[model samples]
Structures are given as structure tokens and as C-alpha cells.
Target: MTMKISIERLGPRRMATLAVATLALFNAGCMVGPDYHRPQVRVPATYSELPGWTQAEPNASAPKGNWWTAFNDPLIDELEPLVVVSNQTVRADYANYQEALAEVRAAHASLFPTIGATGSATRERAGSGSVSSAGTLVNSAAARVVNSGSLEGNVSWAPDLWGQVRRTVEENAATAQSSEATLANATLSEQVALATAIIELRTTDANIDLLEKTVDAYQHYLDVVTEQDRAGTIAPSDVITARSQLNTAKSDLIALGVARAQYAHAIAVLVGKNPEELEVAHSAAMPALPSVPVGVPSTLLERRPDIAAAERKMAAQNAAIGVAVSAYYPEISLSGAAGFTQSPLSGLLKIANYVWSLGGSASETLFDGGLRSADVDAAKAAYDATVANYRGTVLGAFQNVEDDLSGLRILAEQADVLDAAVRDADRGAEIAFNEYQAGTVDYTTVATAQATQLSTRQTALNVQESRLLHAASLFGDLGGGWSTDELHDPRHPAAPAAAAAGSVQGGATSAGSGEEKVQ
Candidate 1:
């Protein structure tokens, strides 16, 4: 007697169940490697250089929508918006941020199983000739053609047994965050540049106005000296001196046009226009410098985009350490395929022609001449570098705030003193010219006093320009109204919308809320 066994009799259903159980067991395994923790950084309690400065109350100094509007300059308000959308450098940074978001999504995709399907058809011909073991032909006939087809579905999953995929996802997430911060930094930088350029342009305009007026006055003096020399009331050398002063003033007036044109061209590029297409009309009126609110130094970490970027980079590098450490363990993958096949196309889907397979694989590097160890060490070194960079960025951010603060404060005082000096110099120039006309002083003394007046006036204008530039720098150093809460995970497209809707009415305020505080 003989016994016959069938797949059904051996319980194929039970085998399928066991395969699923095995897959579940592998999925349930704990991931290897250390969990990520943000690196600690020391922060100062208060700014050292904030003497005589009042700290803004919570949310008091926060920039409202469109920080440039705070300056009350209509031109800046108009140009600042263009930078967010049209500036080439800002646009490039935005694109880079989008790419980083895509990378984050790609990394997230690895956490789940992948399913695929395949189908194929083939026509084959089989020879009818047969041969014996001795190589003697038993039969010979014409070949016959046949058609075959198959359809298959496969599933593959590499379980995160060593947390490699998870760590990769974390790394990419941090990188995307870093990219977002970079985008904000780029935008802020361009906006500040545009504002600074505009301020300088206006200063040039004011300088040109002053020089032109001086040129007109010098021309009148030249006429007076020429008439007096011809009448034998003044020496011919006085006429020559007067002509030289008029020409010098005219030259100074002409030189200002170059800076004005260059600034206008820069503004045009920043607003995404051709240099020749955009023109800013000359205006002698300078916009009054707006008061900027400086928050506490501890908030600098949250307020500065560059600081945020550096911190995110540190987090990313920290996750990379886990990725490198995970290599010490094995990579386990589960794969299975279910299919239908038959010699004829009509029978491809029949239950009797069905086929399936289930399998699991694990691979690990046994030895690679200490390459894995070296990789881990390298990752550690890289992580250490980022930590140092992050700390350095924080220090730099504080320094920026301090430098701007001290600059504004000192410039304010200097402006006051220079204002009085300019008035005194102008009065002295008037006195010297009158004394020369009365034959009490030489024409050379008159020229010296006028030159002193021009120098003092130009100095005052430059001081005012410096104050405006410093204010713009302070705004940028304060993060240009960006906050960590605005950062969105690309994996969730709606996350940013919800966050924006939930954000405070104004821009970023206190640093205690939102994403994890570095301090």
C-alpha cells in the first residue's frame, strides 16, 4: 500500500498563516541603536551689551505682518514684498527647501512595505526530436508552438530591526527643517540688502543735492571774484581759487550719480527686474530711521534663522550617528510573491495554476577591515563638528544683536553732536566768506571754511545712513519674522496651513512656545 499526500491535505492554509505570523514577529522586533536626543547648549541669561536699552515686553516688539511696514516707508513696503517672491537668490533657496522636503517624504516612504505587480506572455516552440542515453535518436518530428502567460504580485518589507530607516527619516526631517530656515535666512538677507541699498541711494541723493547747492554758491562766488579781479578789487589768484572750488563741488556732485545708479540697479535685480527697466527717482528727502525693538539675548536662538539652521543641522548630524551605529546590526527583509501561470493564456487565472512563495532574508557585514567602526567614528566626528558650529552660530547671533544695538546707540549720540557741528561749520563758512569780501581774511581762509562745512554735512548724512543700515541689519538678525512654528513636515502638506492659522495675530513673539527650544 502506498500513501499519497496533497498540498490541501498538508494544510496550505496553515502554512500561509504561519508565514503571516513570522512576518508579524519580525515587525514586532525592537529596533536597534540609540534613540535620538537633542544636544545641550549653554545660553546666556542676558545680553552683555544691552546697557541703557529697554527689553521689549513679550510680544511687544514682535514684528507684525510685513516687518518693513513698521518703518512706515511706502517704498520699502512695496519692494520688500517682491523679495519674497521675485528675488533670484531667495527663489533658489525656496527651491532647495522644496527639494529637501521631497527628500523627507522619500525617507518616510521607507518605513512601509512596498507592493508590486508583474505580468508577462511568451510564445515558445519545442523540438519533437528525442535521443537515448547512448545518443541514438528515438524519434524526430516537427516542432509545435505554444503560448504561456503569468501574472504575479509581490510584497517586500525591510523591517527597521536596527532603526536605520527611522534614523534616516529623522535625519531627513531635520535636514528639511534646516533648509526651511535657510530659505528664511536668504529671504531676510535679500530684503535687508534691498533696504540698505535704498537707504544708501537716498543718502547719495541727499549728498548730490547738497553738493549741487554748494556748486551753485561756489559759482556765484566765482562770478564775484572774477568781477572784483577785473575791477582790480581782488587778486587774480582769488578768482582762480573760486573757480577751483566751484569745479570741485561740481565734480563731487557728478560722482554721486554712480553710486545712485548702482543702487538703483541692485534694487531692480532684487525686485526681479532688468537693471535698465527699473528706475528710482532722485529724492533729497531721507526717510526717518524707525526704532527697532531688541528682544532678550536668550530669544536670539529662536529669532535668528541662521541660528535655527545651525541647530537643525546639529540635530540632523545627531541622527546620522544613529544611522552609522545601526550598521553594526543585521538588515532583515521579508519578501513574498503570489502568482498564476499556465501554458495557455486562458488558464492563467485558474486556481490549479496558482503559485506562491514566502521568504525572509538577513544580511550583515561580518568584517570590513574596521570600515564600519571607522564610519561610526567619522559620523561621531561630523556630529561633533555640527555641535560646535551650532554653538558658534548662537554666539554669533548674540554678537550680531549686541553689535547692532551698540551701533544704533552710538550713532544716535554721534548724530546729535554732528548736527551741532554742521550748523557751526556752516556759520563759520558764512563768516569766512563775509570777512574775505570785507578784505579782513584771505580767499584761502574762505575756501577752508566752506570745505569744512561740506565735510561736516557729508559726515552727518553718512551717520544717518549708517543708522538706517544698522536698523535693517537688526531686523534681519532678529529672524525677519520667521518662527520655528512655521516649519512644516513635508510628509504632511496640511501641517503648515494649520500651524499658520493657529499662529498669533502678529509674527513670532516669545520663544518659549512652538518647536523644541534649543536652550
Candidate 2:
């Protein structure tokens, strides 16, 4: 699947959240933990099976966006675009990515202060009649009513004093980027699956055509044998054999419809539609085998979406270590309230009735039974785990590329051998038929030759189908023209540390700077 319209589909809230993340990314001071760097993986300089492979030159005039068009099949071209747009799995991954971006914004908000307003009103009887003896009558004359009201505004901030908020924002931004890469990986996988199903369906169509022609040929053979049997020129068993072969061919032809229908249904669901709603047309011609370029192994690091996602996860986990380390530092909080209060709701806005308070405090974990130390150790362990996972992903990507290349090469050679065998088998069957017609050979020789021809032809067709499937798989393993450069960073262009620090004043005043304070 391709995401040409990804940004447009995300609503305004998503866009706004991303903007907040961008800002906070540029507003933080020095983060507490280790900065992120990609872990080293030992990659072979070249693909093992692509020793003589020629590098493809980019053509500005040709379309690189849809590489599957190399197959030159109009049907495939029509369906490939739908994988990113309508595929249910792709859409779900996209939603998950959007949610991750929103989380980044939530994390970004922690860098600012919190402001709130409150208002209240009260009504009561302040005085009552002194007479207990004549309570009811005296209270009516002596009772007094009072009304009071107050309005207040308050602001509180703990500051990102030790970069905890910044590190958290960093972690979430990395996570969001990871989610974006995951979406890309899923879309590509679904697109490849759809292409493969179509290839199988096309192969089924070819198989059915082959069987139909075979059935017709057997029918003709049966008619000739029946005529000869009636005249006592051929054995009655030959007639029975011919009829049985025709019936078997017909049965095989009928069975292919089930597989064809299943493949069509799978393709429909892959593009996000009900099976019954889709109508697949039969095309006897298979898509041509495409030439897939196998680049050097090191390029997979920047070319594969899964590798990018794994790398970003490492970054997120590394930032988590910073978030943990930030715990060791002291936290400072400042709060202020300003308001007016008065009796009887009179002069409530006057200077004497005004009330105000300003306060601040600082706290540090004096002792926690090694809890903070445990947290730091856990975060480091998690980071180490992600590093291993990232390297493992890179290794897996290398394996995918190598496997596709080797399979395609070996399959090509096998396909050549089968094609040659098919040609010889066709000639052999023709010769046997001619000899039998001239009474130089028995009918059994003709039957044997025809069966061999059919077997060889079927095997060749299978190899052709396998080659097409491998071609499609090759495109997917090669990242389907994706690049790590396509991944968006909320803090792209990497702002200088001084510039990031300078933005603190604005972030404090406008967005309010604060994170969860350690108690």
C-alpha cells in the first residue's frame, strides 16, 4: 500500500497535535539520559546471489511510483492503489499511528503550566431573634439575610527543571514515528499479498484452459477408438481407456473453478471488499515476470520500513532511560492565586475585598528503598532489549532480501529446463500420434506420449507461476520503493541545543510548563 494522501486523511486535531509535538521538541533543555545512535549490524557488502546483477538507472520519464506496473498487466495496475486506500488492515494501522501522534501532543503539554478559574456564591441567615419563648414571631422581625460571592484564578508550574518533560516528549515522538513506519510496513505487506493472490488466480485460469483443451482432445481420441473398436480394428479396452481419460480431464477442469473462486475472494478481501461484491475477470495470459533490482545489503537499513520502525523504537526506549534518570533530581513547583471575596455580595470587586496568595516548594526523594535505582535499571534493561530487537530486525531484513534473490535465480534455471522438456515432449507426442495413425505403433504408445506431453506442459506452467510469484515477493522485500527519508519527524531539521533552550520562555508563558512532580 502507498500513502500519497496520508496527511490529508488525518483530521485537524491530528494536525494540531503534531504541531504541539514539533514545538515542545524545540523547547526543552538538556535531557538527562544517553542520546540515541543506531546500533551497528554486520551487513554483507553485496547480495550473495546477485554477483552479476546490473544496477538499475532511474528514469525521470518513467513512473517509479508503481513498480508493479512492470508486469504490464492492466488488472494489477488497477488494484495496487486500493491497498493503501481501502484495505481494512492498512486503515487500522493508520488509526493506531494517529493515536500515537496524539499521545505525543499529550506528552508535549507536560512542558507547560496549568491554569484554572473558580467561582462560588453563598446565601444564609446571619442573625436570628433572641426570644426563645416567642421564637416564631420574634424571628420573623429580627432575622437577617446575607449573600456572599467569590471569584478566583490560579496558576501552577513545576517546570521541566530536569528535562523529564522533554524526555517524555522525545519518547512519544519516537513512538509516533515508529507507528508511522509500522503502518507503511503493513500496507506494503497487504499489497504484496493481493498481488500474489492475483498471480495464483491467473495461473488457475491458465490451468483450466489447459484442462479444457485436453478434455476436447481426449473426446476426439475416444470417438476414433470407438469407431475402430466397432470394426474390430482396435481393442474394446482402448475405447474404455480413452473415455476414462476424457472424463478425468473434465473433472480436473471443473475442480479449478473452486480454486479460482477462492483466489478471487481472497483478492477482494485484501482490497477491503466483500467477496460476493467483487467480480474477477478471466485473463488467460499471465503477467510477465518483472526484473527486480537487488541492491547491496547495507541499503536495507534505510530502505525497509520495519527496520526504520525498529530503530525508532530504540530511540523511544533510550529516552525512557532519561525519563527514569530525571527522577534523581529535585523538583520545584510554583503556584499563585488572585481573586476577590466580600460579604453580602457588595464591594466584591473593591481593593479591600481582594484576596491573593503566592507560594512555591521544592522536594526530592530523600529515601525510597532503592525504588528510583530500580526504575533506572529497568529503563536501561528495556533500552538494551530494544537495541537487540533493532539489530535482529536488520538481520531479518537481510535474510528476506537474500532469500528472494536466491529463489528467483534458482527458479529461473529450473523454468528453463522445464521449457526445454515441454518442447521435446510436444514433438514426441506428435511423432507417436503419426506413427499410430500409419499402423506403425500401438494406441498405447500414442497415449503414453500424450500423457508425458501433458505432464511436461503442466510442470512448465507451474514454474512460470512460481517465477511470477517470486517477482512480486522480490518487489516487497526490496521495500517497494520506500525510503527511511519518507518517515516524518515532529522535530525534523534538528534544532540546536541553544535554540531549543531559548524556546523555554515562550513555552512557559503560553503552554504552561510542568510534568508529574515526584512526591
Candidate 3:
């Protein structure tokens, strides 16, 4: 219903009372939608791969510190912190969060009245042939000019009579929360990437060091064989074989440089620098493999930022259903305008020149070929999709954590076996060389033993790298110590200091390595 009221009939006090009553009625309108409840999800009592997993004894009483710090590598500690500040991907997501906050604020604005003012001044002129103001037909119309001015202030509000605006604000607020969680997830992911790159780079350095020492040993063997040939003990063919082995080792050592340089370049980029702009110094040892504490499955729901983001989206979508349902009700609005208009250009603000309007409107779309119903259906469908997405995300998170746990557990056992193999191979190579010198074995036997030693040593290095990489993977899958509770509200953003304490705070199982550094 639309109405027009004259000031002469409805007095100013009555109009004010009407507006107040309208506000009260709308404020009491029932919110029409399903309230959000976290959907039930199947969570395991314990991680599937937790059995026989080596849980780390991280000092709980120790001051909170970075997850990478568990590796005890200064380089990793320094570079890992930079990923959040300078990573372009994280920065882009943060910009997206800023936009989401603006959207929330915009939606919130709809819950209140909109006040505006308008002012206009116009000059009009009439000459011959123009009708006179008195509607008289004069033979010669005299030149006349009139000036008019008007100033008006108006207020209009829809009042959320069926809670449509409130529901919309709820939806946008949830969306902003999801955006914030997404930002945290991105930051965590990039930081893990940086840590992984640094770990691999250090592993490469260790490999290069191993090859260098092997090359040196081959050179020494060649020298001893050359002397034996001069003494007429070893044949010339054996001398030639020794030289070939030395040259092969030298080539293998050189090949490792290519990989080392590439890993370094990758590390530099991960730290937000051009490959050439930054260089990681070669460390003599690889980082220590950290033991991850494997927490129960249910903790993942709150721990993973991606999970939090997905859950928040479900809420936002659910609110959309309320917004759609609200369309079934009539839109009730109240508007009032007060102003003065005068043509004499003198005392335009006088009571005689005052003009005012007080009105209300109720518009119901009685026929739309089921548009509102279709919209409601579409909203419900979208909401269902989000629920599925949220569950899938949770399942994926569990899969990641389990995969990391299994890899670390299986690899740690292999590391132990390889460590023993390396020790045995070292002894065999020593014995074979001594037997050749003592005229008890052939030079070919020495070469075979030495080859076995090098192969086993290289295999051990590979396994060690695998373990470290898996540890980092587990750290990330566990949400990198983030919690949904930390997700900032759009209406009340928190400061940086309010964020999580520095720590790799999560439960993970063991991928423990032997008591050996990268060497």
C-alpha cells in the first residue's frame, strides 16, 4: 500500500510517532531461515597411521618458537618468516580479504535508514509569444523573468520488515570470515613451500659434499694403482681402470652442481627474491628431521584454515536461503520529505512556502511465474553444494595427514636399514682395496666394492631428503598451527599481535632419522 499524507491532516508529532512504530514493528520481525549448525562428520578416534609412529618429545614448556626451528637450521628460520610478508600469492589473498570486509560493511548499511538532501535553483524567462502567468492572451507580452528555489531533506528506509537485510548482512559477514581464513591458509601454504625448498636445497649441498669426498678417495686409489703398475705388481690395464674410475667420479661430482644450483634458485624465489638476488650458503649438514605429533582426527576440523574457510562458506550460503525466502513477503518502506519552495525569491523559508510529504508503501509481487520459489530452490541447492564441499575438504585434510604419517614412518625404518648398509659398504670397500694391495684380490673386486659403497651412500641421502620433505608436508596438513578461532571478524579485526604464538603447534607422528646430520 502506498499513501500520501498532507501536513494539514497528520501533524508533525503524529508522523514522528508513526515512523517510530514502523521501526519497532520491523525490529520485531522473525528471522526466517534455518539457524546454522555444524554438520556431523565422521572423525576417526586416532589417525590410521599413528600406530608405531615415533612421537617427538618437543619440550612443551619451552618458549613458543617457529616450526622450522625444530630443524635447528638458522637459514630456514630466517627465510621461512619472510614468506608471509613478501609472497605475492599471500598478498593477493589479503587484498581479497580487504574487499570482503568492504562488502560486509555495505550489507550492514542496509539495516538502517538512508538520509539525503537535495537543493536546486533555477531561473526562467518568458518573452513575446509566451503565455502570460495569468493565462491571459495579451497582444504584446511584456518580457518577464521569475526565479524559483527549493531545498529538501528526505529519509527513506525499508526496515527489514521480514529480516531480509539482516540475513544479507549475516551472509556477507560469513563471507568475509571465509576470506580471512583463506588468507591464513594461503600464508601457511606458502610458508611450507619455502621450508620445503630450503630443506631440499640443503640436501643437495650434502649430496655435493658426499660426491666431493668420493672423488677425492677415487683420486687416491688411482695414485696407489699407478705406483703398483710402476712396481710391476698391477697390470697396465688395472692402472687404466683406476684412472677411468677417478674420471667417472669427477664427472658425477660435477653433475651434482647443476642440481645444487637449481635448488638454490628455487629457495631464493620461495623467499620472494630473484634467483640471482639471493644465495643460500652451502651447509655442511642437512637439517634434522623433526618428529611430528599426530593429533586425533577431530582436531583437524578446527585446526585447518582451509576447513574453516569451507565451513564458513556453508554458513554464508545458508544465509542466502533466508534472503531468498524473504522475497515472498511484501517490501514495506517509509519515506518522509520536508522542504520549502518559493517563486518570489524572497523569504523562501517562510511557513507559507513550506511543503512536506509523509508516506509509506507496501509492494507485493503477486505474480512472477514462480520466480521467488525458483530463487529459494536455487539458494537451497547452492547451500547443499557447500555442505558437500566442506565435507570433502575435511576428508582431504585427513588423507594428507595420514599420507604424511605413513611416509615418515615407513621412511624412518628404511633410513635405519640404509644407515647400516652404508656402514657395511664402507667396511667392504676398505677391505677390498687392502686385499688388492696385498695381492689377495683383483683390481676389479676393489672397483665393485667401491661402487656398491657409493650407491648405498647416495641412496641413504635420498631417503633422508624424503623424510624431511614428508615432515614439512605433515606440518602443513595439520594447519601449521592455525585455528578457526583466530579467524578475524570483519566487524572487529584483530591486530598482528593477537595472532597465534610462534610454534609448530600440532600433533604429528614420527619420521625419525638416525642420529646423523646431512653429512
lDDT of 2 at 235: 68
- Find the candidate with the highest TM-score and give its number: 1
Question: What TM-score would each prediction reach against the true structure?
Answer: 0.87, 0.86, 0.86
**Candidate 2, position 391, lDDT:** 90
In model 3, the Cα lDDT at residue 366 comes to 93
Error of 1 at 457 (Å): 0.5
Q: TM-score of predicted model 3?
A: 0.86
Q: Write the per-residue lDDT of candidate 1 for residues 52-94, one digit (tens) a residue.
A: 4346546756864477776666677767777766777876776
What TM-score number comes out for model 1? 0.87
Q: Write the per-residue lDDT of candidate 3 for residues 334-431, one digit (tens) a residue.
A: 78898999986678899999988878798999999999999999999999999999999999999999899889989989999999999999999999
Candidate 2's residue-wise lDDT over 16-86, tens digit each?
A: 58545644543455678898887788977677787764443353422245878988787788887877767
**Model 2 alpha-carbon drift over 4 Å, by segment:** 1-28, 52-63, 137-142, 491-519
Q: Rate the local accuracy (lDDT) of all candidates.
A: 0.79, 0.79, 0.81
Q: lDDT: which candidate is best? A: 3
